[model samples]
Every structure is written in C-alpha cells, then in structure tokens.
Target: MPVIALLLLDGVPGPHVTTPGVCFGTAARCHPRVAYEVRLCAAPGFRSAGGPGAFGVTTPWGLDGLDTLAEGDTVVVAGHSGHPDGPPPGVVAALRSATARGCRIGAVGAGTFTLAATGLLDGRRASTAPGLAAELARRHPAVDVAPDGAVVVDGPFHTATGVLGGVDLFLRLITLDHGDAVAVETERQMFLELYEPGPDQGVRADAPLPGDALGPTLGWLEARLDRPLTLDDLAGHAGLTVRGLSRRFRAETGLPPLQYLLRARIQRAQRLLERGDEPVARIAARTGLGTPANLRHHFQRYTGTTPSVYRAAFRSLVTSLTPPREVPPPGPGGPPAR
Candidate 1:
C-alpha cells in the first residue's frame, strides 16, 4: 500500500496528531481494498508539551524514519502548540528531501506556518487556521495566504484550515486514490457526510437545514416542483430580491437557488425511478422537466447515467435483495396443484 507519513512536532495538539490517522485509516477500511498505510512520525526533537488530552503523544517513528516516504507518498505536517517559527532543522531537511523525492506535502492548522518556513509555500496559495492567517501572511511574504478556504490545494501541497479540515483533506485524497463511492462510505463511517462547500463553514448533511431563513421557502418550492418556478417566484416567496435570495441560497446550500432546484428535481426523479415503475415521460413531467429528453439530459448530467439505465440498475439491485420463491415439483402427468 502507498504510505502516508503524518509528521508531528514537539508540543503538537492531540487532534493534529490523531485526526489524519483516523481519517485515512478509516478510508483504508471503507475502500474495497486498503488505500494507503498511515505512519505517525514525530520530529527527532519531539517533546510533547501541552495540557490535558493534547500532551505526551508517543510514536514509533521519528524524523529519522522518514526514509519510508517515497514518490507518490504523502507527508502531513501537524500544527505545533508553540510559536510557529517551525520544526527542528533536521525535520525541515527531511521534509525538503521527501518533497524533492516527489512526495506530496500537507499542512494542518498552524502547521502551514512550518511548511511555509521551508519556502515550498513561496508563491503558493495556502490557508491556515482562521485566526492565524494574518500572522502567516505577515511572516511569509511570498506565500499567498488564503484567509477563508477550508482546504487549499496548490500543486503538490495541501493546506487545511483546522483539524476537521484535516479530515476533509484526507478524505479528498482518498477520493483521488480510490473513488467517490469509497470516500462516501468512509465519511459515513465517521458519522459525517461530504459537504460540497467543505465543513469549515459548519454545514453538514445531518445538520439541520438553514430553517429559520429558508425552511418555509423550501417547503413552498417542494410543493410546487410540478410547476414552473423561476428565480423571481423564489425571491418573492422569501420576501427578498433576486440578488438577496441568490446570496442566501449560496450561503446555505453552496449553490445558486436554480442550481439547488435542479438538483432537487433530479433527486426526486431518482426516487421515482428507483421505487416505482413510472415512465420517464411521466417522471419528467411531474418533476417539471417538461420532456423526456430534458429529463435525460439533466439526469445524466447530475447522475452520469441515462434515466433508463439508472432504472435498470436500481431494479437489478432491488431484485438481488429479494430471495427466489421455491416451486413444488409436478405430480403425475400434470403440474402440481397450488
């Protein structure tokens, strides 16, 4: 398996040390086959220094053990609790050598500062924790500090905004290694769902929708999916202008209102295709897609398969779930009685 070297520094927080392991380790299990091997490595000068649950982490590998990092392997730098000056010179050299050998680099939380110190982030766009972005920008003049992104990927480096962002980054890497299906299962195992806008914005699948602002509007829209609804209708229903409604929809769902509506229609069509034997024409009409060709276009665009093919696949899956019934043998010259 490909290996991921999770580098921890002295005084690093516990989550920074553990989150990468859990995320990638769980991904390995969730995949049909193991995706990557995770190795926890502490700097040679590592001395855990913090309070409560975040202190005194033990690791089997130190900076010296980074010999295992090879081309296509990953090196994740965890944030330290001390000033963001950087890790030991030995650790920096090891990271630089590993990068030269074609290993991908990642920084979590304030670890971006350490990676920035190596000058690899020079002229690269990266984001750190929300509060530390300013200091990182001030300290590293050449690095393009992204103040608001949860996860920033520029070339061979990946930088995350916080510990949870670390989880997202690993999951994204898993998706790149495996596929979206494996990543979805992995996220499910973590009791989380992949939020399109990234979780740094605090939105998640299981979390309640933005009800106070859009609940009534959503209900109004759902009740009228069979009818043609425009942006003006949505804005008027929500008592907002078009621009205001668009902004609120983007904030809540990470998409424009029309885009969300299109997704919603496709989802509804998917349910009908899976659970019922409705014709594509009827489904299309009911979902306000107007015509079968239009439904097929949008359906394939969103789901990557034609409506008929999707229905066949769903039916095949449903059939596999049901056991076959046994039939009695025929008696005499005639068939057996019921």
Candidate 2:
C-alpha cells in the first residue's frame, strides 16, 4: 500500500490530525483494492491543541519517517493552532528532502503556512483558510494565494482551506490515484457531494454554494431545472439587473449566471443518471437541457465523457460492489407480513 504520512506539528488542530485517516480509511473500506497506509508522523512528544481539551497524541513515526517515502507516496502538512509561528527547521528540512525525492506534498488549513516556509510553494498557486490568505500572501510573496478555493492543486503540491478542506483535498487525491469511480463510491459512502473543479479554474474547487443574497434564486433555479431560464430570469428572481447579477453570481459561485445554471443542470443529470436507468432524452429534458444532443454536448464539455458512458461506469462500479437484495416469498392471498 502507498503511504500517506500526515506530518503533525505542535498545537495541530484535532480534526487536522484525524480527518486524513477517516477519509483514506473510508476510501479503502469502500474499495478494498485501493488502500493507503495512513501514518501520523510528528516530532517527539507533539500534542494537539485548540479543541475543548488537549490530549497526548502518540504518533508512531518521527520526522525522519519522511525519508522512507517514495515518489508515489504523499506527505500532508497538517494545520496547527498557532500558525503565525513558522515550522521548526527540522520539519522544514525533512519536507525539502522529501520534495527532492519526488514525494507529492500537501497542506491543510494553516499548514499551508508551514509548506510555504519551505519555499516549495513559491511560484505555485496555493490556498489556505480564507481568513489567513492575506497573511500567507504577505509572508510569502512569491506564493500565489487563491483565497476562495476550497482545494487547490499545483503540480505535485496540493493545499486546502478551512476545517473541512482536508476532506475535499483527500477525496481529490483519491480520485487522482484510483479513478473517479472509486472516489465517487467513497463520496457516496461518506454522504459527501464530490466537488470536482473545472479545468480552467487552476485545479481549484470552490467552497459550498453560498446561502447569501442569491440563495433564493439558486433554490428557485433548482426547483425549476426543467424550465428554460435566461439571465434575465435569474436576475429578476434575485432582484438585480443582468450585469449586477452576473458579477455577484460569479463572485459567489465562481461561475457566471448561465454557466452556473448549466453546471447545476449537468450535475443534476449526473445524479439522476447514477441513481436510475433514466433514458438520456428524459434526463436531458428533466434537467432543462432541451434535447439529448444538447445534454451530450455540454456534459462532454464539462465531464469529458458522454452521459451514457458516465452512467455505465458509475453503475457498473456500484453494482459490482453491492449485493443483491433478498425478497421474502409471497403468501397465497397477499405479500408476506412485515
């Protein structure tokens, strides 16, 4: 199994220490063939802080454990509470050494600061907790900071923002390692919506759809996915002019109004396709794509695969893993009693 070593610094947040294990562990359980040996490596006697209580976390490996990692392995720098303080020299040196050996590196939350300190993120687009983006940019001027991205991947370096950002980051990593099938199954088992970023977005996934001024409009659009909606309709629903709506919508959802609507429609079509054997034409109509040809065009553009192929791949993976449900025999006059 490939190793996913989570490098823990002192005062690391509790979730930062545990989320990787949960994510990769769940992925392994969901797809037995795709597994990772998750290791929590820290300096001697490092304990976590910033939750309701502090506790001793006994990690099996020390910083030197990073030396054992190879090209296919990964080292994730977990977030610490006192993030303003730079990481220790030993940790920085170990990370630099690991980079030299071609190990993929990632950082979660404030740990982006730690990775940035090593100059590995220099000239790379990285993300951190939204509130800390300015400080990260100020401290490491060479590192391009994308404050709004939930997860940002630049070459072999990956960075994620916020408390739940690790989940997104690890899922993305799993997708890269295994395939979308495994990652989608893992998401289903974990009850998480897979947040695949667009190609032009610099490998950046946006945070959850906002519940701000556009919330009502978004909800309305979702309810009426079967209807033809224009920019004017969305702007009118949101009580803004077309230009204002376009600007604000892009600012909030990271896509222009019509583009966001198209994405939403495609996503709904994806779910409908995965859940049942809905004919492509019906699925397209239900999602307001008008015709099967239009659906195929946009779906291919966004997902890089035709709708039927996507459905077949997803269903085949799911069906292979799931056992058939057993049904009780019927009685003479009626179905068997509960």
**TM-score against truth, every candidate:** 0.56, 0.58
- Candidate 1: tens digits of C-alpha lDDT, residues 1-338: 78888887787777777777778867654332456777888776788844337567778898866786788899988877764556676877888899998989988888898898888889989988879989999999999999774789999999987645377678778877766756655664564222222222222111123334787887788778889999999999999999999999877656688877876687678768867888999999999999999999987776567889877876775576344655768878987586
For model 2 the TM-score comes to 0.58
Per-residue alpha-carbon lDDT of candidate 2 for residues 1-338, written as tens digits (9 for 90 to 100)? 89999998888877777788878887776443566999989854476555645676888899978989999999999888766878875988899998888999999989999999999999999999878999999999999999685689998898998455387789989989977756765665454333333444211121133446677788888889899899999888889999999998777666787887887787788889889888999999999999999999988887777888888877776676454666867769986678
In candidate 1, stretches whose alpha carbon ends up further than 4 angstroms from where it belongs are: 49-52, 192-338
* Per-residue error (Å), model 1, residue 172: 1.7
Which runs in model 2 stand beyond 4 Å of their true positions? 192-270, 273-338
Error of 2 at 195 (Å): 23
Best by lDDT: 2
